[model samples]
Target: MKFTRTANANWKGTGMDGAGTISTQSTTLNKAQLSFKTRFADGVGTNPEELIAAAHSGCFTMQLSFLLSEQGFTPEDLNTEAQVTFEDGTITKIHLKLEASVPGISEQDFQDTATKAKEVCPVSKLLKAAEITLSAVLL
Candidate 1:
């Protein structure tokens, strides 16, 4: 099966003065880019890397949750943070940190499942250039 999303951006002016609109039609990201500072502090449209981080984090967490459930463990909570590092003018690494509380699951089991999830998740598979690293903590 294949899935896809469409987004468009329109920019004007220079780096400091330019602004853009990021839209996904009528979806959540429609016309959503008035400012795009690194952390949205300078009033610029959101950048691609930031959007990639958001997608990776959400996708990885859901994949981990599903994997845990399939293993007959109930996950109390799953927290994930994805750091996208850029070097030499391009994205170089994706660091993933996942913390999950799965009742009735051993640390080893949890870690194993997390490893598989990271390998098999759609976003993880899509990112070939960036190095993907993961840290899974069980509680």
Candidate 2:
């Protein structure tokens, strides 16, 4: 399946002082505000790193759910959080923390499956330049 998704950003003024709005094709983030302060400081609105984290977490969780279904294990819940560590103008690491509830799955099997999902998820593959790590808990 090959497809394309797009998001647009409009900025005005200098990098540090400029403000921008981002709009996605899906309109999920229609005219969402973003700015240098939002990205580098605690200012309100969204930023690229936060968006990347959201994408990674969503992708990984969905992939893990598919893998679990394939392995004959139905999950009660799968909560994943992706932390993108951006330092010195680069994304140094992405850490995935997963809390899952699956019936009758071994710890080792769960860990292995999560590892596989993390390695194969589309966002993970695209962000391979960053060090990716996972801490999965089977609750």
Winner by lDDT? 2
What would the TM-score be for candidate 2 when compared with the true structure?
Answer: 0.98
Off by over 4 Å in 2: none
Residue 103 displacement (Å), model 1: 0.4
Clashes of 1: 5
Model 1 clash pairs? 35-43, 35-44, 35-45, 36-44, 36-45
lDDT of 1 by residue, 1-139 (tens): 8876788877788766667777875477877775446333554456777788888989989998898888888899999999998777689999999888888998889888998888988899999668999998897
Question: Can you write out model 2's per-residue Cα lDDT over 4-43, one digit (the tens) per residue?
Answer: 9999999998999999999999999999999998999988
50 Cα displacement, candidate 2 (Å):
0.5
Candidates' C-alpha lDDT: 0.83, 0.97
User: What does the lDDT read for residue 15 in candidate 1?
Assistant: 66
TM-score of candidate 1 relative to the true fold? 0.86
By summed lDDT, which 10 consecutive residues of candidate 1 come out lowest? 35-44
